[model samples]
Target: MDVRAAACRVEAPASRPLDGTVVRASGDSVAVRVAASRLRALGCAIRTGGAPLPPDAPAGLLRVERAPWISGGHALPECRIGWSGPVAVPMAGERDVQAACGIMHVHGRATGGPRALRVDYASVCAGVLAAQAVTAGMLALLRGGTAVRAATSVAQAAALALTQYVAVATTDPGSGSSRPEPGAERTPPFRSAGGVRFEIETFRAESWLRFWTGLGAERSAIAAGWPPFQQRFATATCTLPPGLQAVAAAWDYPAVRRAAQAAGVGIVAVSDAGTPLPPPPASPWRLRPLPTAQATEEAPAPDGRPRTGDGPLAGIRVVESANRVQGPLSGHVLGLLGADVVRLEPPGGDPMRGVPPMAGEVSARFLALNRGKGAVEADLKSRAGRETALRLAASSDVFLQNWAPGRAARFALDAADLVAVQPRLVYAYAGGWAEVLPAPQPMGTDYLVQAHTGVAALLSPPGRPPAPTLMTITDVLGALISAEGVVAGLLGAGRTGAGVRVETALADAGRLLRDTHEVGDRTADATAPVVSDLAAMAADPAYAALFETDGAAVYSRAPWTFTRPSDHRREEP
Candidate 1:
């Protein structure tokens, strides 16, 4: 993907000037390169140096660095490196960090392999996050706040990527029963009689039953498979009975597809690695300015005083109505940045709140992302609920939602509607496909998006059927992209005094991941065996430090650390 082209396409034309130099220390890590490339695309003059910048450098200068571990206090013992088949080589400490964070465990469980080992993923995510932090710091300086320095580690990034897994593992110790033994082959990407490999997605039990029934699957087998199949998103493991696989294998690809279409199921043929992927979106997220009568105000220059307390978005307010991982995790990241987030839920609250593996009555999965956020109960289908939503948006700096494409417009609470009342708000929508794909869209869930965008093929082992890792890859990454969009929109709003609409989709996130990483045949050294016990690793002192538990619920610590000049003391002369 052309990083510069994507950046140029979404450039904040109406925002205040972002003129400055981004000084990057020389580093070979993919994370460092990604961050520098993105910063340069944002119009920051890039300067590479082997040494740290001089203390007397220009006030506009910002430094970016990538490290194996940001804590810099304790050194973790190097563990055995597992075989990284057909994936990018692991950088220094990459595999170790990922192992400690339980990423490999989740991947291995989902793929039915010893361990789906790779490091490129965490590094890429860290790079995007670093760029986000730099942008926020820049925004703070433009708002007359003190200059700030931000730092992140590959470990922290991996931890953030596995936040949901940590939540589930900590809350329910028995969840490990679903993990497949090493060398076990799981079913999902079932092979047809015609030698075609494909994946099917069905949301409701009826759809699952109908699809299997049309394919001549046994009633008992279909009924037994539904629980595990539906729970894969949360458990990261799906073990379907052999009868279901046999039923699929009996039919040819076209016949299987016909059955799926007749049953209202989503199906996609597994792509090959050599197949060319569709061009990625111009940008992962779209930002558009909203017309408002409010007059723009010139941004105040930096005052040189150190920014104190909280994060860059200390005083910002975000109102979010999101479900599942993508939307809630976006709001969670915003909260970590010190924004006050108020979650708008249905009158009885989000049903996800009752999902199993409870952490003191609240769902551990829900608590992972919505821990510190405030909640508001409103029946969005009702007029009073819409009024309440509008009232909240009128006073908030950002309004985020991930409802179906037309649900917001139907409720009269879309970007146009909210901006009419609060002209300076930043409205963000995190959807499944956006407007990129044709209509009659498949369900906009993570695994389906993976199959549609060829991500399933990219991660599959050589000669294996294409299968999406049940790790919620696109959901987590989409959330990160959405948060980045919200921050960018906020910056644009600050500069122009007008509302902005930020839109991103799961497909876009999948495309970004697919286009950025190049998959090849070079495999890593397989000297050490794969680690299997995630719970044991989580309890280890070195890994335990990365997470904190609250009432049996565990969550990752903040990924980035911010420091200002005031954090240090002046020497007495």
Candidate 2:
């Protein structure tokens, strides 16, 4: 209940060093103080800019503190942070909050979904990332007295929620378009005979095949494609209309559970019984310091974008050699905070580049994360490619990769190799699971992590099979976590001139969801309205602006703003 760790006593340092100023403006000084305390916990020697707080300042960074879910789950660090200045932004109020929610709402309307799902979808995801941002900023400060600022808008958070399927470009060339196929959006729930609900997921092609084989059902029982609701019937046969029939209705929960276990597929029961899921087992983030080898800090900067800007990570360089969502998204976050990121691809380019919904040769999803980044081509298997990659590593402050376990070292691209090239580099790695094994599994994926880590079990609604949360929730979370670790490493290197290795996995990200103790966990909100009329929301001028279209594509305004001195101009260095 005490999200601020108010009862925990943090001894102040005997003497404080003069650091940068933090300009904070929020009606809730308590929330501001909480954020300040987090920064101080990181050992930041910051002073609040001594200025008057603006009257109509938008939520700014402090909105993260006010997020309903922040105070729950894992407790905040214990140090008390102090500030001296007032903040600005004359045009912010409740309207801003509604406007932000409204923007995501409009996006949902464009995609077609229920209003309730729209309202909280972005907020929940944003809240998670917001909390991570605060923690990451603190981590950076703790590593060194770096003046790091994390500013994210509700809209940005909303956009992140959509990352799972947005422009889910298909690899199948015959599909003719990059848009996701119908029914690919969600894995539907099926009702059991006793009116209970449950769900199952197959992250890989082999999974559902195993499910059918385990049930001793004909292979034909499996759907031709990855439809979320193919198993709506309880009959062992696959010949049933989805969404109309309660397939599991023929079996009880235990029977269904047995069948899924026999198949070796992941499954969970749905509950509308209003029981909240348990909190995460451990803290969402774990930062461990690793031993470092002494070396000169003269690593050559990689050839890529000339980062010309000012922010927490200004002048920092990042080399990204990962693909799909997690690695690129982490690089994307670093870019947002003013890091110069260079994305490495093979001769043909990233596999994601070929996905459909293309503006040109690249997919929108690729553009979303890869924009503002420098790009290069390399063949990691080739001697020349390895040398090129090494050069890039030698010339960078950070290097991130999501290659399968042991694959990096095989390619001579692991942390040890890179650290040898750039000793002060912050090397980050993302993976599918946390545990290291002698042998690698087939592949780690977001869906599998959700099922394995009890995320599906917790999200299961009453009377329905267990279901996954948003597609790739753990994937995105893992990326954010990895990004935080990278920043922390960078700050640490800044202070001690020692390189560090940061690692995160999709499997570990599932723990963040578990750790999230919902705000006022309850079955019902007596004060809340039953439903919101989309039409009424669309009628408002401010809300309507959110739906504005630019030709065939719809455009949105940035949901949040940063007032950092370094944010003044974005130019190529």
Candidate 3:
């Protein structure tokens, strides 16, 4: 699909003034056009034909455009770039970016062939990052900072998508051994005797055991499959015992589903391209302003030190209690925008913090999303722990969480609970299925949500069985949307002097990706050699500067670059 056509389909809310900023888009790249669309959706007036503003115009004027490449204080002309595919065009297309950044490598590892996502994944990501940069710039201006120029490339965005994988590849000695051998029995999208292909999910080992046992699988096979299945999220590869597949294939889908339900496991049949699913939310998130009468005034900095930074959220404080990729990544993005984020962990800290591939004292995957954040250990189930969280929220600008459904409310750490104590807070909930699916929702993990929403089908190559991309597509995109929503909520709160509630879901993220355009045969070259080695890719001078190395760990730099006029000046990326 043409990048611009696909970008035009991205849904954004009606325009509303975000401090009456005059945003403009002048480049023809997909990233530039989509950022303009998003800014317009956020209600910034787009300046198409206006008198050129004075070079020193106030901070409200913002521009978002694309560049061929941005690295080491230099941006090559769009026409001079020549690594991805065809050089005849001004910029590389999405497929070239995907192949170059190792996205296809990770995405196709389990699917038997490397292919770009049917959706314009990289361009859309870059566009969203661009929009986020603009929003952060606006926030910086509102917070009494100078105007800023931000730039991002599709390659940078693609590299950001591979951050977790890169972290593991660079830090873990045993990472390479986790890859599935050719023709090995893979996991999930299991086919039943009736020929129904589906995905199943359960975080608890006991539940997994029960689900498999209910399907009459041998005890040893069930045990053998559990570890790989559970670790798939972190490792992006699942090699299961053949007996498990045999057991699943012995029964019809109804029987398989019945066993799943009896075992408290979540199950969803892989959807087809023509399946009738609920439409995605008009916008990726729902933001509602709470009554101002109950709102608390913004808290003053405890140390009384003035915040100073080029990033938009210089002094904002965020309290995040989230487990996996979606929620933690949201906080990470906020941190990238200059927020001071403090993680709320359990008494022993998050268990994932110890999951393999250690970078210093923390898991490389965990650090990928949590690198500059502070941590506080608290048990939210206890009254004292709840009070600790409440106190943190009382002094914070945003409280972000992605606990399982009702888990927050059960512990009285829900949005309502937090907003009551901190009425000026932006309460952001990154959830799964968020009233979109019917009662009895499937597990809200990335793969299952993809299956339930037909994203697995949409991303699968032609003639291949529906398979979820192993790259955690929805989790990452959902994080982007979550951060964007939080920023929007913060802006609304700034305008209305009230707390704002922002809710987003994995289901919505999947829906957005799937429904963005009609599925077609557009895919990257499946026959091309898969470039799965991110560490090697990072070492190449073409992308080396986009990553930073600490000890043995490698981390992708922030995708967007922000600079003030005094620091440097550039009209394009």
The reply for model 1, stretches above 4 Å from the true place, is: 1-25, 52-91, 111-113, 178-185, 291-295, 298-309, 519-522, 526-531, 566-573
What's the residue-level lDDT of 469 in candidate 3? 76
lDDT of 2 by residue, 1-573 (tens): 332232112222111111221223243322243334434433443245433443332322332121121222322221111111111111122223223333223222312432222122333344444434554443333322232344544345544444323322111222112123454333345566777655565545676666555544444535543332322110001222333233355567787777777665666554332344344323223333335546323323345556567444667788999987789888987887667889989997887665545645666556656767888999998989999898998888888999867789789887778877677777788887665212334356665566556666665545545555434556776786677667756654543445666777776666645544243222332232211233333233544333322222232222223343243221111
lDDT of 1 by residue, 1-573 (tens): 322222223324532223333344345455656666655644455566554423322111235332111122111110011122111322244454455456777887765544544326676677667777877765554344554566666667777888778788877777845456444348788889999888888878999999999988889989889998999888888888888888899999999999999998988777765565556544446676875525344322223223334888877788999998999999999999878889999988999999988999899889988999999999999999999898888778889999977899899998889988787788999998876467777678898788777788877767766788888888988898889888877766665556788888888777766756663212554333344665555565655545778867778877777667454322111
| Tens-digit per-residue lDDT, 471-570, candidate 3 | 7988988888889888887766654556778889888777666655452224434333346677877676766657887776888887766666564444
Task: Give me the runs in candidate 2 sitting further than 4 Å from their true place.
Answer: 1-151, 163-223, 227-286, 289-292, 295-307, 435-443, 460-465, 520-560, 565-573
Report how far off residue 546 is in candidate 1 (Å).
1.2
* TM-score computed on alpha carbons, candidate 2: 0.63
Inter-residue clash pairs, candidate 1? none
Which prediction has more favorable TM-score, 2 or 3? 3
TM-score (all chains, Cα) for each model = 0.84, 0.63, 0.85
For lDDT, candidate 1 versus 2, the one ahead is 1
Which one wins by TM-score: 1 or 3? 3
On TM-score, the stronger of 1 and 2 is 1
